[model samples]
Target: MKILRKERGGHMLDSKLIRNNPESVKKGLKVRQGDSSLVDKFLAVDEEWRKVTIEVEELQAKRNKVSDEIAEMKKNKQDASRIITQMKEVSARIKELTDKQKESETAAQKIALEMPNLPHLSVPEGMDSRDNREVRTHGKKPSFKFQPKAHDELGRNLGILNFEQAAKISGARFVVYHGLGAQLERALINFMLDLHTKEHGYQEVMTPVLVNAKSMTGTGQLPKFEEDLFATRDDNFYLIPTAEVSVTNLHADEILEGEKLPVKYACYSPCFRREAGSYGKDVKGIIRQHQFNKVELVKFVQPDKSYDELEKLTKDAESVLQKLGLAYRVVELSTGDLGFSSAKTYDIEVWFPSENQYREISSCSNFESFQARRAGIRFRSNPKAKPEFIHTLNGSGLAVGRTFAAILENFQLEDGSVEIPKVLQPYLGGQKKLEA
Candidate 1:
């Protein structure tokens, strides 16, 4: 198991990066000083196996010819024992070659799968998340005249959040929104969907929350992050962690017209994640829940316009927070912090006064044809031109559950009340405040 060092650039590379650069994969293995000869060994084994198979085939052909001679001899009342013995040896040799072929193929596939993707030119060299850069900060952090309350406390007092009831229904790390909280969550969903579809020119869509194993692997979720997903035993389907899986795969194995090069879509769905590695982080609130609602934005664009589309996509996500008057900052994730399929990722972190730090509310990323290649989503430049993979980008307009939590934490007054943001007033039934 060779661990490749993270490379320096502005963006992370797609998983297929190794397929595009075979030498880099070997160099990566060499860097770890892990049996760099395995690649050549596999190739040699494969070549030898092929040669042995051909030899076996030639022997079998001779055996068949001799067998025919024996049959003709038997017909003529002559000896056939020597021909039968030769047939047995040829069969044994064939079996040996067949077994060797299987071994070589298995060994080759094992080595192939272990190869890592090449680091993108834009990905900055870093060992871990600590090296990530803070790109920019948006709205000023609100200064509370008094001590601020955490979202959990504020939500419980206001009779909007019911963790105990949620625990009874599901298990721990789940939340039950009641009355205004429920309404507010729904409003956020509608607001985001409408904004993206009506203002941002995205097509609204609804997708399944449970997807098959192939769908998971197509997005680089399986084979690597399987434990972080909830799988159904009977059908082998896993609950989706984000709408990205479903929306981006809508055109899987299909080719679209060049005119539709940039296909923008917004979807509202309930996302599920096992959060297998997060044992004690954000355990008390909706920030790290087993399930949550989010309005997701996905786009398929021409490779040339992908980076520009990423900026527009990021702003599309930002508009939600801007409308809600949420104080948030945009951070450029370092290579180590980038997700499995993203080349570049921008995380929108909203201020949480109680925690006295910013927390991630949404992540917008440009996959640069990574998912498109896996999913076989392509677009033809002309009616007769060859199809090429389209760049895929997705982001959460906002995670409704986290947005709800942020609102409670950031807008809570000293008197144990939560003020509704002006933009959400209409959706909140004109209610100005949430109180116990």
Candidate 2:
């Protein structure tokens, strides 16, 4: 891997950004170092291509000269057959070189696009999510007088969640929400979206669930994470894993004004994840599933304000759990455990009393310009000034499915009824309790 020299400019294009830019990718090979060998290989291939091109061009020039000579010879009543044979040979050689050059260029492009982005300076280096760091805790964990029941047991006993029937209809990892369970999930979505839009000042948006490959890659979900997606063969569109993909890509290829520095958006959508590698984890409940509802918040801001914005964003997500009276904690993901696109991340984990442990329910990340560069989201300080990539940040206001699960497990009484939180009662049509 060549470590490309860091060029001094108002904008700093990282490896992912350069890979997405054809011209930058070609130029990056000449400077960067981590992947210098790959760059050298690509350069060697390019040099060979240039040599072949020059050779082909020279051969064509010679063939043209020979044709003119052959014409003169014919006009002078002399033999011209030898020149014609040589021209045919030159044309064949040119075709071969052209084909080889085309193959080399295609191979280079594939390799370039497949490379992952480098970890940001602030990101902690780790291999997986388990290596994440615990940042802080919020609200106290509930202590039950009686033995607590898992969400699945409580939900089944209360006649609210039906996993068996859902499997019968849609296969495994799916659940049917009934009675208050269904209403609770719906209320959470509406509640989160309303809070972000009305109080948080985020614009409410609804984006397409199906998007192109570029949209996925722009959000750091492609090339390496392709296995975690569900794709359609027709036009190659994938079902979005979260509304983040659509909302973040809203300004894809567009430049905005600096006055709009902190552009905020809130969205609610059904997310789909293949969960390809997780065969048994969280298989008992909606914690890890194929389809789940989520309310997402995304923002675009000046680079200098990103970290501050990250804290606010995490608080914004925490507010939802707080309002619901759910016991949860904030964990700062370590360098080794952060997602590919995130420079830094904070995971909000809600307590599940039955499991006697906190489980992740929301993830908020400050990607800086990682997603913006790929999505071509930029901003200009002045009308005539050049545009630069804006920093991108996103967090789950709350995962509706998990919120529903947490409420069921944590609020269940000895009698098997679940009490609705005061804040959610209005959205639940004033229902005070979920009784079987």
Candidate number of the best lDDT: 2
Error of 2 at 270 (Å): 0.1
lDDT of 2 by residue, 43-107 (tens): 55556656766776787788788888988999999988877887788889878876776665555
Best by TM-score: 1
Q: Which stretches of candidate 2 lie over 4 Å from their true place?
A: 1-108
Candidate 2, position 62, lDDT: 84
Error of 1 at 246 (Å): 1.1
Error at 140, model 2, angstroms: 0.9
What are the runs in model 1 whose C-alpha is more than 4 Å off? 1-20, 25-117
- On residues 1-436, what C-alpha lDDT tens digit does candidate 1 reach at each position? 0111111110112333443544665554443333445456545654664676677668778878887898899999988887788778878887777677566555544443333333355656565567667888889788999999889888998898999999999998899999998999998898899889999999999999899876776676766678899889888789999989998889887899988668999999999999898899889877899999999999999999998998899999999999998899988877666776777888999999999998888899888866776667789978898988788899999899989988888888889999999988898889999988
> Each prediction's Cα lDDT score?
0.79, 0.80
